[model samples]
Target: MSQDKTILVVGTYDTKDDELNYMSNCIRGQGGQVLSMDVSVLGDPTAPTDYSKHVVAEEGGSSIEAAIDSGDENTAMQIMAHGASMLALRLYREGKIDGVVVLGGTMGTDLALDVCQALPLGVPKYVVSTVSFSQLLPPERLAADIQMILWAGGLYGLNSVCKSSLSQAAGAVLGAARAVEKPKGDRPLIGMTSFGKTILRYMITLKPALEERGFEVAVFHATGMGGRAFESLAAEGSFACAMDFATQEVGNHIFGGLSAGADRLTNAGATATPQIVAPACYDLVDLVGWKPVPEQMGDKPAHDHNRLLKAVVLSASERRDVALAHAEKLSGAKGPTTFIMPKGGCNEWDRPGADLHDAAGLAAFVSAIEDAMPDNVDYVPLDCHINDAQFCETVLSIFDGWLENGVVKA
Candidate 1:
């Protein structure tokens, strides 16, 4: 018989015992084993739990009895969330669970986020919550690969709609656990960051060249969540090397625009990952046309990339500051690092006479990076745009050298 996949079903069993039981039965029906973890702080769970509320609360540094005595729902839930996350992570590490599925309304979803974030990528985490993908929970706060489904008609009781949603969630997680191939340890994994495909065409050449050379390249979108995932994966030593070409998130993060949280652009250096850093899209910051523009971008070149997505051009002064910020982060790298400057342009939009083109701004950014770059970092200035064929060749050649010199391994 094939090994049965175990899915950890986490929720407030005291409140949603029937719902949890239904989901557990669904998972069992799908030929998967279920490990129920109850995070309820009040009342007893109708179903038997492998990890009871008392066990969960204790992991969170409090006991369920203490939480009940305190009489603060928020505090008790907070404690339960932490404890549940700890227990869930422990179970995953011990190979007791192959996937996790959690269901709830607001409180359950909040706790689910903790559990999801506690697990690493490729663990098949799913959350069936009423507040599915709500803006209140920013992308940076959750795990990069969490799959959330709207819990339609799932509030207050068991019903046909709730059962359908729960059943689908169970099947989805089980299928994922069965089909998802775990990462192979054969080829070295290379993490690369880029914006839109059209905007960052170098990846087309960059990716194939690296793959041909026997390295697996993973490209991450330069959005807030994508950046956070890249950073998180880097911190976990998931990459043999990284080519961080898209840095618009840094501008947004430093300027309080739509940022990738406070941790953008700091991971590879901290983790000693050999990285090639570029200011590919650092000249722009993300903003929505519906929101009021920042005073710092007053009268500057702004491109309405789309109705809701606007790119504000940074001035020469702002670009200089961003370069300095890049320096501050890159200078502390414990591994071999290179900072490349593409002098012709940073992005497709930054080409001469393009919407984001500004000669003075580019000059200021390059100059600041050059002046501030530490001796440990190799600073290379190429007289070509970032997406140029020559620039791609230059980067690949450097990677080849790194590979041969043992700076990066295949």
Candidate 2:
């Protein structure tokens, strides 16, 4: 392993020997030292196994080949994934590697993502898979399981695409190595979640407000990847606080909505960075269009923006469950936190008279907060709705509290 370098070629030599070897050569040829570590599931390895998936497999309960010998690729894949994550995380802890580059076929991408997710944020990571382009592989499982782990943008397994993606990924890793020498300042990063509705509000108002108060905020657009990316950074210790102002996606997660589950919903908040987490827009579910709106929701309350992408008012039962769950999740925050309720409504169309507004649901939402909230946190109700300027200001004020007192010892 090259301690002096950054890019590390990580893959299973059992299958991707040729591709990984090529990746290693390209990385070194471009002025980046490459360390080839085997995440091989085939027992002993020829390449340096910095943190073997075999070890993780052994430790995490199952071996891949053992599972395969029983004629179960599905089981083997599951075991391999769990083991890969453990192996990558071990390497990350020891600091023997910096960046990771992987090459594989269908099984390769699946196994590769397992390793990617385990490594921390900002590390250069790449995966070149032959099965990447095919619809044969389940995109949702692949996405939910592996996307966050790739330190670099991913490449499809197609030959042409791999060639393009690998070259860029290799060069990017080298650049990351060259750039790491410049130490960053001490200002803590803050994670912010918003949507198109609030993006403008944040840009014109909140963004400057946060920066002026000394917080370096990273905003996520409440979309699946965007939300997941923020949580990923948070788990990697990237943010000191968060303003989860747009949580409408919870309904999207529960429904089969096209958005995303955006894993680790409560992760950053629970880490305790003086989180000002709220039920922001927990009152409604995002629908691609009004056509899919369930029969119970009635012809789109008044703010049905367009026939295609309409916001459906959540049911009284759905609102109660989600609000209860949201409050329960927000309570997981490890740092000082607050949950604010705006008396009027949550989003643009959620005010007192909007068609999408479900005052019954709103009351149930706050009631759940009051009844189910964890004792470790504080729950405060405001005299405004989500779109109200006061609610925005209060959210910022809580972050300010963290900016003053949220340095956890390293």
RMSD of each: 2.5, 5.4
Give the CA lDDT, 0 to 100, for residue 242 in model 1. 88
Instruction: Give the distance in Å from residue 106's predicted Cα in candidate 2 to where it truly belongs.
Output: 3.5
**CA lDDT of every candidate:** 0.87, 0.63
Candidate 2 colliding pairs = 116-149, 117-149, 129-157, 270-333, 270-334, 272-334, 272-335, 289-308, 302-355
Across 1-410, the per-residue lDDT of candidate 2 in tens digits comes to 34356566766666556556666777778766765656555544555544455665675577656756866676776676676667666665777666676666667677776677676665656666655545444323333223222222333222654556567666666666666543154665667887776312543467778777676767786655566666666665567666776676766677544344445357676555656666666766666574656765555453455665666667677877877677667666777767777767777666666546677878877777778878877777888776668877887676555556544221
- Name the top TM-score candidate: 1
TM-score versus the correct structure, for each prediction? 0.91, 0.74
Clash count per candidate = 0, 9
